[model samples]
Target: MAGLIDKAKNYVAEKVANMPMPVATVTDVDLKGVGIEGINYGAKVSVDNPYTHSIPICEISYTLKSADRVIATGTIPDPGSLVGKDKTILDVPVKVPHSVLVSLARDIGSDWDIDYELHIGLTIDLPVVGNFTIPLSTKGEIKLPTLSDLWSKNPPQSSV
Candidate 1:
């Protein structure tokens, strides 16, 4: 009886391993906005769904790191469902406090940008497969807003 159970478990594991799952990638990460409280960065993720029906996303978990230190981490629960047989785009927002940015002055002061690594987990529920997570990661530098960008020349004036 134990042998039979072991064989069955192997069969199930093999099937799960061969199953087709959704593909996801982190397309872009950019600085979105700045506020009095903090700076907002947005990560754009594109997921391709292979199923015929919409799949519910359990949650979107993200971790933002800079200078080998975690600056922000959070999860967005029940973000939405993915479109069937198509691609869906989702935005994950990370808010970095002014204090946190100030703490990384050494890295920022040298290049006028912050080097970052973003890790995103796209979790979804499948019919027979239970929960599946697609892990995505991206590394790049986010340029800090310059004083000139904020206080630059005025908009083009049209002659009346």
Candidate 2:
């Protein structure tokens, strides 16, 4: 009985891990530089199920903020009806002309001592598994910035 249970757990974990996280492309960057306002953003999320089993209602939330304060928040529409071998691409758009000013700089000027990050992650529940009983683990975030730091790039000094 114990052996059967362990096998079942491993199988479950494998199935969960192998599932693909819906990926979206940040098509364009509408906002730039300090004190800049009215930013426009667009993203294309492509949903493709690599697993043999079907994924139902794959919904993801996207967040935008100047810093700690959230300016806009919305949820991506999951593919309606049964998603078979066909992959669906969702084009997402958000229009925010003004945002609450936080300490975070709006501009990425020449000094470029700024931090702009795009964090795209998935949070969903699998219908096949038990609610609360089954743990739908969340993945880590992948962060990207325009530059490392202010004085990091000095054109590589040579010591003769």
Report every candidate's CA lDDT. Answer: 0.86, 0.43
lDDT of 1 by residue, 10-104 (tens): 99999988878999988887777777988888888999999888999999999999999999999999999999999999999989898999999
Those runs of model 2 whose alpha carbons end farther than 4 Å from true positions after fitting are 14-40, 51-54, 66-70, 76-82, 99-115, 124-160
State in Å the error of residue 1, model 2.
3.5
Per-model tally of clashing residue pairs: 0, 5
Residue 41 lDDT, candidate 1, scale 0-100: 80
Q: Once model 1 is optimally superposed onto the true structure by TM-score, how far is the C-alpha of residue 142 displaced, in angstroms?
A: 0.3
Q: For candidate 2, give the lDDT of residue 48.
A: 57
Candidate 2, residues 1-160: lDDT per residue as tens digits?
Answer: 9999999999989997775543334433332222245444544555555445555555555665433455556766663422555565545554444433223334423333223344444443455552211112112111212333222442221111
